[model samples]
Target chain A: MRRLRSAISTASAEFQRHYAHNRRLAEELRERQERARHARPQRDLDRLERQGKMLPRQRVERLLDPGTPFLEFSSLAANMAYDGESPGASCITGIGIVSGREVVIHADDSSVKGGAWYPLTIKKIVRCLDIAIENRLPVVHLCDSAGGFLQLQSEVFPDRYMGGRIFRNQCILSKLGVKQLALVFGHCTAGGAYIPGLSDYNVIVQGTGAVFLGGPPLVKAATGEEVTVEELGGAAMHTSVSGTCDYPAGSEEEAIAIGREIVAQWDRPRKWDCQREEPEEPYYDPDELYGVLPDDIKKQFEMREIIARLVDGSRFHEYQPNYGTTLVCGFANLWGWKVGILANNGVLFNDSSLKGAHFMELCNQNNTPLVFLQNITGFMVGRAYERAGITKDGAKMIMAQTCSRVPKFTVMCNGSFGAGNYGMCGRAFDGRLLFTWPNHQIGVMGGDQAANTLAEVKLKQMQRNGEAVDQAVIERLRDETRAAYLEQLSAWYSTSEIWDDGIIDPVDTRNALGMAITASLNAPLGESGYGIFRF
Target chain B: MALALLLGAEAAGIEIVRRRPHLVVRIDGREHEVVERDEADGRTRIELDGRPLALACAADGNTRFLRLGGRNLRVSLVDPRDAAAAGEGGGDEIRAPMPGSVVTLHKAEGEAVLRGETILTIESMKLQTALVSPRDGVVELLLRGEGQTFDKDEVVVRLASPSAPGPSEPAPPEPATAEASPAADAKGAA
Candidate 1:
């Protein structure tokens, strides 16, 4: 392997302009993340304080081993939903180190609506548990949510991947021999009680924690029997009498202590070996990534410049550097784990798509993980390319990528449109983890292209119907379509819909991938071999 | 295979011969006996042909720095592939690999430029690619100004011919050379 020589001139005027523009985007990202994590109404904070409870983030921090990074998923899961009522979908989910073991932490944000589960909240929790099941990571549930929000019960409860999926995933995880622990700090009414009940181990705070299929009010309404909250399902009764919960703690802090001890007792997962070396920081400064990214979404930059700032020692062993010229495929160490990277340098052509498919097969054969840095518009479209079999070539790449036995990770570095998304491991591809940058956009096509395409279709329809082909009306419709498309194409909307794990700053990509790769090693590689290639 | 190391402007090829009782090596076709020991104070003791020297060495990526007798020297490994690629001289002109219009002009004709310095940037298929100088030379011509479009394989800019009298001298008409050499056009294509 050799160091990739960066061609970027950081002192150029263009570099300065791009630097200022992207720096502002990064700053805005920081502000949004800060607001989602900590900003809450004064009343919510006061109520939690009054109840002698720790904030959700505080509990997560104390539960994790000190100084270890927590790769949070969907930090802005519902930022565009619920009229901004649910921040982080009113819960916190991330991969963190707990008692020297890698565990996924799902802590409910009690500060928001008493930690009520919104429609998107259930979606986020289900996605988190799905991640645990996929990676075979142990789970720690900080039980504090107010069950499902009844106002949106239709969306939260009825569907296949709704509230029921969370408990279903827990059962699957336990069946797979994955460990789980729940610490109850608040009332677990109705479906929420099953969270602790399904876990292998659980701890409950004596005074504030309680678990019951039906709360006191529900019990009163249904059975015509009056009962106090403690008598119904308190920590002492559940731990001593019913054996529903294993540990009883006098306070929230004590419950966390007991939870950590329980996690320490479980067997550590045997990580399947992948080629690893002593980790080293990238030779190029990651901060330069700001300038390397273009200000405009459509504008293209060298993918090698981005790769230099991401891989270990800024070194890459480029594979077939001169053959494809559009799709850059190579091997690099990300966080010391040897990974095969497929990054789009331009529109995928027949040769480039063939190269990508071949490289993916090689990675699987070598038992190396694959990382896709997607910044593609689409495959080249033309009569010449069609005759050359661009579609089948692209299908070959997608087929090889979809059936890859080694773990795959994807980072949406920029534009992902059309079938380019599929070839590059889109959300539907079962990538172990997928992250998007703040500037990323994903759609069937770009805003202008989509608008133009629809406008053309409408124009032909109007002609066929003998309607007035009014230019003014057509222009208005184009602009409206473009505006709507642009909004939904943003990274925020993608993350809000949980299309990606989360929108991350460009500089944190290495660390995010590092954590993802480490967690993925807990599970062995999938069965090898691929379906038939078009060629 | 010999490992190439660059010190200042010079390069040396070294290969190890043996490492049993004492280290034996060949440097530039000359063999030498050597021994190395690590000192307690973080310095390396080296004996070359029965002469001893002590130095503190540190490495950053491919580059190594040595502090010996209060003088600092830097040595770096020269990857053979890179050296071979650079040795195939084709830094005379910048050509358009694809049909695109210039977005920005970083350098004008008659200006001195270093190898890898951007002469202009062109946008094609929504991609902005910088066309850089192939080697250290003076710009002889800027065929495409900002916003000017050119066809594939068209010469975007030409550096002063190396055979010219001086760096400031403009390149003379050489249609034959441009037509005959395919490697010159492929330089910018990469």
Candidate 2:
């Protein structure tokens, strides 16, 4: 038995040696083929890639491995031209390895007609996509296009019958199983925005970048809405409202950082568990909101300041900054799914702000949860009225406030009075829940206004009595009495009868809100895909 | 069935004519009496529900284009689908689906067209129908005369259809968003 075991061991060692030698020889053969491929003169490829005109190779080199690389399918392609210099066709697509794993990169050359999608570039883009399908690789598009080249595009597609069909033809490609991401640092507008919107995520910088569907010139002819280039299409537009883009950073470096982080985190899509269902704060102190607001309710403060305090530390995206300046509407996270909010900014009062009400109303129509900050010095009072169309705007705001389906809550940080109060979800309104600070006041006017009015009335009565009364002392007395009445209204069975749900402590405002919002009838509970809108 | 030549063609579930078409068409699955006479020239008088339904068309031999109100019709000597499909070996023919001008041709003649390959775009009523290749095939023809409108169902090109199985192709998944269909009237148009 011992002699048989020794013979078996010797035979196994010889077999192992043969197997290792064969694997080494196969590896050597692969290296020889690689060398031969490199040795073959590639004048056309080298000429097309002269100077830094085409960055497909460089992009792959920086993004993936330079030597240990995967083969690129369409390294050199001519657009429209059957044979000739098509100028690298705006977009260059190829395969490469990232961390030894294959990935497809389609890098647009801004040098090529400012990276426009003339009819020539369209097919070039499809070339990369086909490669993605043939070899299941994630797609990374480095886009910096000005927009569709209408003039060149017209010259290219001579077929009169198939005009704009080319533009909408990419509907199915977007749904294909490719992990897509877009990086925009240059002019991305009009048709340019479509590619980014279709991608899984987009990273953009603030100052150096911009994005919009149809630029200002087109917008002017269509809608007559005038604004600066950046104002019309900026980081804020995509990140907050349209939900077109996922990340917005201040600089290119920041955008790259965010992109890197996103790539690291992006595992195949999974259901996010909102396990921390607790509200950010408790409902004990409504007065804690007062700390965020200025001491005097009559003195207006930015509602955003209050919102910052209420939301989970900087978890909000406010949209339409210039369109509706007064009332701020944005998408924010309470636990997981985004909640839409439209709150009144107490300090800023103009036609701009009233317009914000109508905009917020639109958000309401969409069934996003709203939060209204109470404190506005009433609507604008001046020639600023008729010119800005504040009347139609105000009515629209009221109708929007009336027709909301999502749960709404309001905090009376002070100054919940008049028309502004109704617009900001005052306790008297149909807001889901209303809370107030200890210094809460809900009346036709502020305590200061009431004090002045009452002091004059009392002084006149005293004068009629022919009794001694100091004007200064009477003013002080009136003010003190007015303040007492204001407090009394927020107390026990007064506001409790109708105006308020409950009062919470100042410090517990965030927790209280989290509780109210998480506990309140959460709305927008419906199947996804867009349905018919009454608008 | 004692069929009028026009009615006979329609009974076979086929359309041989379009513009100023001579064939009888079934609407709501019912046929109405129509007369074609020429006062100055030979034109058709369309009568339905005991009333004259307007029938107008521009015509020539081998093809006559007709329009009765918004309904469009075209008459042809041959079946465009069969002619194109037969050359392509029983694959869906990528044709000018609508009467519109072609804007661009993405591929050359004899090139293979994959499913969903954008053959060309057609511009009609300021809207474009991206004429995509319905199946994988080697292009047999590329009739991309940009800026010229062709009648609906007109043969634009033919492809030698691919032998292997094609990609998942889209049929009529959805109609134009603006096209008012009876099923969806939940909200007034924005």
Candidate 3:
């Protein structure tokens, strides 16, 4: 219960510099979000309005409870994909409260490319469904997509996690007793038709909404049958004739109102309430987190200072505080939910690896959730450390962490390389959620280190082959490899690939973690046990 | 009505016996003079029988941990019904719950100390874990101290049974004075 005696100098020059840099970064993030939100072309909005249909965003606004928060995911998805054409992947996904129940909202951005499912659009949709499944929250699909983007079907249609996985996830969700309501506002043709077909409830708008395996043009092409879209699969036909949809509405407003009423009829869930003290502002300003993280990934900063700014009231109960020098393990409250924190202060040596293993087990035993703050260069590897069985020690940690039943969250605060990524619950470990900061980078090793190591290998090979060891060739190799590493290691690149949930601003870490933790409580804690250690 | 508390394994009956002219608390069977000396900024300073003790106490539900004398002591307010349901056991010797290296010892072997007095400090994961005495008695053996590493549940200190003194028993020395020790530095740092 000890309130941390802060060692950070809040007013120091370094702190001020960090605060200024972070403030600018936060501003840039806001600008990007604003631009992405407003990027829809004016013509598309007018066209939807002319057709007596509401824009995707307008539907979401009407569906959610008034004045509630909406935590959007990948707002800039497909920004770089589709040759920079698809804005927000031509779709919108977020968590918002509707009918006083937290639900995942998946809306189609018809303004972009006629709401076609680009490769990135499929990705964004799948990710949102994954969130719905994990949190056990009901999903409301604002289905208006124009099927798959034919120009890039190669990328969208043939992968395990692509177009087909959408229906697969919906089936899994239904099996788990989670509910879904589909509001069809526009055409859902071909593969997209299954969105409403698989949902537990479907509401279709009369004029624009259609659900069919093949649209009218496709039907004409396949069988030379000329039929109108409304006669083939419109709201009236589906609700009365085919019985495919549950509710039929005359307009967009009527459809959303019906969706809200249906959600209210469903049983309310008993929210998980964690044992906690009243929430308090952190003793130290979270802004200081900017100053605490070094601009250069190679440099080190005190992790406790960052923890002080993230936890409730900056209070912590450190477990086994002194022995493991490179790792800090303790328990703190994030938004009043108790979480066991394992943050790296430096590289993982034998002692730190063992400490991590022990701390993870303790958290699981206590039914506390885990949060990993990773800024690591990987496990210590040298003659002295190898002699101490560092590899086996690291394996023990990985074994324990992999088997832990409690939910885990991770943040790549800075450098994440090699085995350190696995040890810290990186992408491979299936943490409930993972995020990266703008300055964060991840690779098998640092760019400079990888460049130097590869260059050395090539130079030695040239010597052995009795060839001229040109310094120019070696320099070019290093530069090329370093550039390639930097490109792949950027947070934006990782986020575009869905390597993490999203890239969050450093200052928004508290709220983001709070929301994530709350959402994670949808599932009960699993039984505690871990794999056998290597001794 | 009475309540029992288990502070790091030692059970005690605590009751507010009197509240006039300064609060009096009965710990176990003895009444001690107590008062809230000062309380501000999450820290509480209390005078126990004339000796001032400063603590930073945080309550999580019914379980509270007090950071006193440089140690985080998990204090649980036990329900008398539950305590009577579970039969008592014995682990008279002090043991470590996790593996760690002993940092510093405030007293030597065979030194007499009061219940709840910190015996030594152990360092693990950059945290100093204070090893406190569960009962007032002579320290019959200081198993591990000062730079020595020990495993989980390994005894670090042992107290003589209240009646029979162990072998090599030294006369119970006067209780160690607080003014000359470094433990004073731990007051209110929480």
Candidate 4:
């Protein structure tokens, strides 16, 4: 073996220029994350304090063990939705250790619009619960919501991944013996009451907590009984008279303490015994990644350079270095976890596609997880590539990825376009988790190429219809379509639409992948198979 | 099981032929006694041919990297059949696998080179790859020099096998290496 000699001059002008540019992008990411965390108005904070209730984040802090890592998801969800009204999707969800057990916490941010279940809020809840089931993690729900917002019920009520899915996932978790605890700190009206009722354990705060299919107003309208709020469904009645709740607490703190005790009783689930070594920092300064990373999507950068910054000790064992040059296939350690990496250096050629499929199958057979670093224009086009069976090769890669039993993680490192997205485990592929860098762009094609294609179509359509083709009209249409496509392709926009789990800082990539892989180990790897090859 | 060793850009077949107290490994048909002298804190101390080699070995997911003989190598263990299929080409002209700038010229024209000796260094994305000789040969043409750039698959150097014909190109012009400034930020490296 030989020491990998680095040829980069760190202090060169070219390196400095790229460093400055990427540093600015990293700063921008920090600012956005900070803003999202504190988006609620000051008035709301004062109101919550005056009400003698802890903030949702404070409740989480009290529930989780001190010094444990809390990997929050979608902290800025719905940032581009709800016309700037909802922030953090009006709820907070994450994986945290509570009483020594790793549990998924879905705490509603009651500070924002009474922590109502907006469409995005429902989506976030369902997504978190799905993670809970897949990873065999228990769930702790901090119930403080006004139930579903009636105005947007249509959008959230009927979808397969919306309102009903949240309860469905809860049922699945219970059937699998994954525990759940609900701390009822606020109103649990209508469909929301099922949250606490269905949980394995429920702790209700005396005066603040209430649960019922219908609130006092709806109850009064339906029946002439005129029962008081306390008698109808308060913590006292539910805990003492009815068997709806397991524990009764005087305050939020007491309720959290009770919730912690319940979680402490459940045994920690088994995790896969993956081969591991003590983690080491990558040999290169991760900050140097800014210097080597290309700002332009068209620019070529060695995928190994980025991999060097990510894997432990920057020691990578490239799998097939020469056979498929366009796609770099290799194995590296991410936080001491072995992962098979397939990164794109250029458009996917026939050989590169076959290499990807082959690597995926190997990883599956070895029972190792995969990480895909995508930066592709698409599979190669033209007659020479077509004759090489590019389509068959791409299909083989997709099939291999589809049947892979090991966990798959995707990072949209750069431009993700066309069928390359599917081949690389896009949103539609159901990878355990997918994240994007703020500078990433995704579309069926690039904005310029898409505009040109549409413009050509419009010209042909006009000529066929016998209408005189107006050059100005065609130009206007191209610009309009290009602008819209560019906006849609942006990472921020994609995250808002839930196309990815979240938009992350480029530097946080290593830790995020580590957390995802660790959580995935809770479930055993399934068997693997694939479709017949087209050839 | 066999290991597929990607030594630089070439893949070679490796298998464990014997193991008693430790292991005897065969790499490209050559056998060596390999033993783990010490293992702790993610680093492995291995002895090959009775020469003590201290290397840092980290396993993340399925990827493994080994630091050996002052070089960092990323190695993948693969099925032996795939390794057998990865035979080296017998071309005289060596080309750039990807677009990059030449960083170092390890040998000059007419220099006798052993197989696997570093021929030239190309930097792409700030990572340097050392192109090594495929067989015992004499440098026929060294077209690229330090700081000269080349595109993917472009012929950058040529080698004359022991029994091959003489060089077609005449004596090379002496170009000052390392004196050429990087063209632009985009053209500096990959």
Candidate 5:
């Protein structure tokens, strides 16, 4: 592979403008992430400190290997929900190295509402477990929660993928021979108790950590027998009397130490062999990515420039470079792991779709993981494109991508709209991990297009009813629709709703994908075969 | 083949004669023994033909800057392949690489432009590509205006002949062959 030639002029006015704009976005992202991770009400912090407990992040840091990176799932999981009450969905989940073994950690943020489980919190936890199951990674559960938020019980409890799915995933993970360890740091009442109950091994802190089907008040109300929490399910009762928990610890720190030792005893996953080489730093500065990305979402920039800054040694071997000009399919090493990258330079044309489908097939056959860098608007839409079988070609691409046995990862670099999302491994495609940049937007169509489409429908409806089509009303409607669409299309909303795993800083993309790909290798490749090709 | 190293206005040819107990190099047909050592103070000591010289060196891409004897000097390595490729000058007419419409015109006719300055921007297949000047010259004509469409291989801009007088100068045209040779020589020198 040869180093990609960069044509960017860092001293140009455009570069300066984009650098300033993107730097501001990145700074804002850092600020929000910092606040979400650490900021808490004084009362909550005081309560935890009084109870002799560590902050959720502190617990996670201590549980992880000293200096290993933790790829946190969603720091702003419920930033837009619960009336700004639940930061990080009142929980923390990420992939981290525990006792020299790769494990997914789910720590309950006890600093918020006694670490209650909101609707999105359950979704986030379930998503993490799902990742664990898919990648065959072990799980370390930091058990602490006030059960489900009762006010939003309808949304959090009854649905198929709500609270119940978390336990179901836990059961499946255990049944699949994947290891799970629970370190009880606080109350795990009702359904939360099942987290520790179902784990392969569990440890409970003496004074603060407790697991119970119902806490003291609930026990009093249901059975009319008033019992203390320690007697009901504390470390001494569960570990000694009930035999529900495996180990007892004097404090949270001791529990973490016990948990680390337990994790060390688990067998290491036998990762399937894949093409790997000595990792190389990208020749181009990854910081230049701020200038490479455009300020405006509609503007176009070369995807090769992004790939050059992301891949090893800034090297790429482009596949079908001339045949499909819009979709750049290539082979590059991401953190020494050989991966096939499909990046969208423009709307998908027939040839581009065909090229992508072929490239995906090649990657699967060669046991290489697939990485999709999506900036797609949509496939070409016109009489000419329709006649050219663009729909069939797109189907071929989607089919190939969906059936890919190789681990797939996606980065929402910019726009993701319409069916282009499907062909490029959108959230529904079961990508091993999907991350979004702060500037990313995802919707069925762009805000302006959706607004115009709605306005046109209204105009036709008014004409059919023989009513006056007020221009002011139409304009107002258009503006309102566009505003609403823009809000929903934003990366914050997508992440808050758990549409993606999380929003990542653009420069951290390489590291995030590296960790994801490494975790994905724990599982062998899936059975490979496509249902059918439209071609 | 000896590699070319450019130091200010002078060019030197250097080839490695042998790599053994000490490095041996032939510079401009003279064999010289060279050895390098790093001092504790982060400065490099170079023994060129057994004459010790201490310098601090910093490198950026293919160019190296040295601070020696209270003076700063820059030395750049020029790849023979790149020099050979740069020697082939572009044609007088700039043709479209693909069927596209001009989106922006950065340069106008009779304007002096640098070798790599953007002449215009064209949009095709939902991508915009910038067309840059092939060489330092005066633009004689812009065949397409903004928003005007053109076919592939069609001439989009034409440069004034090297021998012809520039529009701004209004001077008499020189003999074509007699002026072209010196212009080529000047480009090579640059």
Candidate 6:
């Protein structure tokens, strides 16, 4: 009996101690939960807005560190009409911070009238592009749209392209150094496809979202192809072929997470890309190309073959397959260096001078290499010039080149004359090296020159009275004199020599250019950067 | 395959009256000889005053190859500083070259714009990448907003711009011994 009482008392004491400890632990847990709940809770509206379910104001939360000091620009931006009217506006863009990186974004929500881009959207985007280029910012785009504005097309009306004035901002971005990327969610098609297409990197939600150049209806009408929108322009289609999107995701959350992840891929201003798994040997040796071209100036040549032979064959890209025909410009891999290259075409005259200038400009902008092959005669002169508006159109080329700061090289294949020589970076131009085939002959005059010279000599000798053979000699000498004048002009040391950095054997031209470029790269800075001599 | 060769008379100093991008030559060595070519189509063209000679050859003349005159030729023109933007793959903006209705702003204005981001959704060729922003910049301005239209690569946004202005400085020298390429960065961040 005594032992049982003692055991009961001990057990009661143990229970009291256990109850007090449990109560204290539970109290602490509740307090921590309360604090966490109040600390920067994710706003429901913000989540809904991103899901294409709310307005911009509703989606925007404190984008900076909660309760930390930060300045807000254009804090009250909204689509409130002049008369306080509520309308369909799809994009919401403004300055804010996510983890301290100051950035602006143009977000389109598909739930809002299919997220169309109208005149206002164009202006808004242009403004964003211009500002980014001018400031060299790291741009981010949060995209979710069906495509263009079908309903609001009539709201902002203009005679020419409906307010396209701000469209040039893209070039400005390219000219300057800036970083851009696209994130896709929901249905993206047609115009929406480009958002990720032209970016440095693209991320897309695999199953929940898709991107295409045209939606199914348009596709069916245009090409009689009645496939689903996603089937035609899905994440896989974009990332694998067409060289459009770079990254593909499985879900919206994954896409956004990838967006945040990609944004931090490079340091603040510097840019970057992923290296693809490729073969060991390059496409071909640039040196083995001595016999790939025909000596005929009028013959056609495969430009891509040459590029493949010169660079890593498997790692080059060409843009605008149908735009310019006179010249070629794109990015390529040389040795291990990533670079931009501009080449002149041998058979197309889409815009010779204009193409040349563009090459120069691209070289300067991207610090790439510029190469030219001398294959010319004269532009279709006179009436043809008027029809092509050569003067106005051609000048833009020079402007682009004149502003370039990249290295340049040229090879003289055949007959270059007048502006022709200039176009090929002649002694009077900016080629790092100039070389010509042994069988080359450049002159200002052709066929009639030789005939005239012989005629002039014969007539002069025929004069027995020693009287000067005036008119006959003059008329006969016309062609020959012109040829001789051209010859002398080309040979003048000042004309081609002092003006050139070097001249080499045609076969060794590529090596010589490579050497010169290595030596002059990022050399002394100056006004002579890309300026044309004697222009 | 039609070709022509041009040469300076007497091989003296070269002079010029004009320079165009492409040229064709007509040669005759056999009965009823003929050829057609588009050399300048895929190659870079230089308009320098030099000599060129056209030659005739067999019709089966290695169509897979490029023939210059009677000899075969190949020319390479790749740059040395390609990267994200000018690199194989990177994000870039495609803005409008001029204002127009969002007649077809296809891509989402914002998202993960890769090296070739196409935000404006422009239309040309009855087709378009039509407008793209050149460099990587965040969509800041977007004056047109969606469902509206505007002109050119305008200030859509102050994208990719360093959030806040850095020192009133300019582009720094390229980093030597690059620890990471753009591609690596993309993968690393992921």
For all the candidates, what are their Cα RMSDs to the real structure? 4.7, 35.7, 12.6, 9.4, 7.1, 35.7
Looking only at chain B, model 6 earns a TM-score of 0.30
How do the candidates score on chain B by TM-score? 0.58, 0.37, 0.43, 0.41, 0.60, 0.30
lDDT of 3 by residue, B38-124 (tens): 665757788878888877788974689898757789998886534552443223587763456888898787787654456887754
Candidate 6, Cα interface RMSD: 33.7
The per-residue C-alpha lDDT of model 6 at residue A16 equals: 46
**Per-model DockQ against the true two-chain complex:** 0.20, 0.00, 0.05, 0.06, 0.08, 0.01
Q: Please report the candidate that would top TM-score against the real structure.
A: 1
lDDT of 6 by residue, A336-410 (tens): 444555544432233555655655665555556556655444333445455667555555555555445554555
Q: Which ten residues in a row have the lowest lDDT in candidate 3 chain A?
A: A1-10
User: Candidate 3's residue-wise lDDT over A1-535, tens digit each?
Assistant: 5566554455656557666776676676677667667766788878877888777888899999999877777776765555668877788898889998888899988877788988888998998999888778899999988788998889889999999999999999999888999999999998889899999999999988999998888899999999999999998899999999999998899999999999998887665655666777788888778776765565555677778888898888777665565677899998998999998766687888999999999888888889999987788765667888989999988987888888899988887888988888998886877877877888887788889999999999999999999999999999999999898887766776667777778878888888788877886666667767888
lDDT of 6 at A40: 24
Interface RMSD of 2: 32.6
- TM-score between candidate 1 and the true structure: 0.89
The predicted structure with the larger lDDT, 4 or 5, is 5
lDDT of 2 by residue, A1-535 (tens): 0000000111233334433543343344345333322332355345434522233334445555446534432222341142323344455555544443445566665555565665545655654554354233456666666666667666434543222333333344455454666766666776667667777788876755678877888899998988876677777777887677788877555665565555555444232222332334211122223333443333333455445545543445656644444456666655433466666543224444455555555564565666766655455434545465655555556655655555567776655556776667665455655665544556666566678778888898889999898878897888797767666544222222224543444445555555444434312222323222222
Kindly list the per-residue Cα lDDT of model 1 for residues A1-535, writing each as its tens digit. 7888776678777788888998898888889889999999999999999999999999999999999899999999999999889988999998999999999999999999999999889888998999999899999999998889999999999999999999999999999999999999999989999999999999999999999999988888999999888888999999999999999999999999999999999999999999998888999999999988888887767788889999999989888877676788899999999999999877788888999999999999999999999998888776667898989999999999999999999999989988989999999999999999988999888898889989999999999999999998889989999999999999988998889999899999999999999999999899988899987
lDDT of 5 by residue, A1-535 (tens): 7567675677778778888888888998899999888888999999888888888888999999999999999888998888889999999999999999999999988899988889899999999999999999999999888889998899889889999999999999989999999999888999999999999999999988889888899889898998998899989989888999999999888999999999999999999998998999999899988987878777666688789889999988888766666788889999999999999877788988999999999999999999999998888776767898999999999999999999999999988988999999999999999999998998988898889999999999999999998999899999999999999999999999999999999999999999999999999899979998976
Q: Report lDDT per candidate.
A: 0.87, 0.51, 0.79, 0.79, 0.86, 0.44
Ten contiguous residues with the weakest lDDT in model 4 chain B = B179-188
**Number of the candidate with higher TM-score, 4 or 5:** 5
In order of listing, the candidates' clash counts read 0, 53, 12, 20, 0, 216
- Please write out the lDDT profile of model 6 over residues B118-171, one tens digit for every residue: 355432111122234333434434445555654433443333454534333323
lDDT of candidate model 5 versus the reference: 0.86
Model 6: how far residue A260 lies from native, Å: 53
Off by over 4 Å in 4: A1-7, A459-473, B1-190
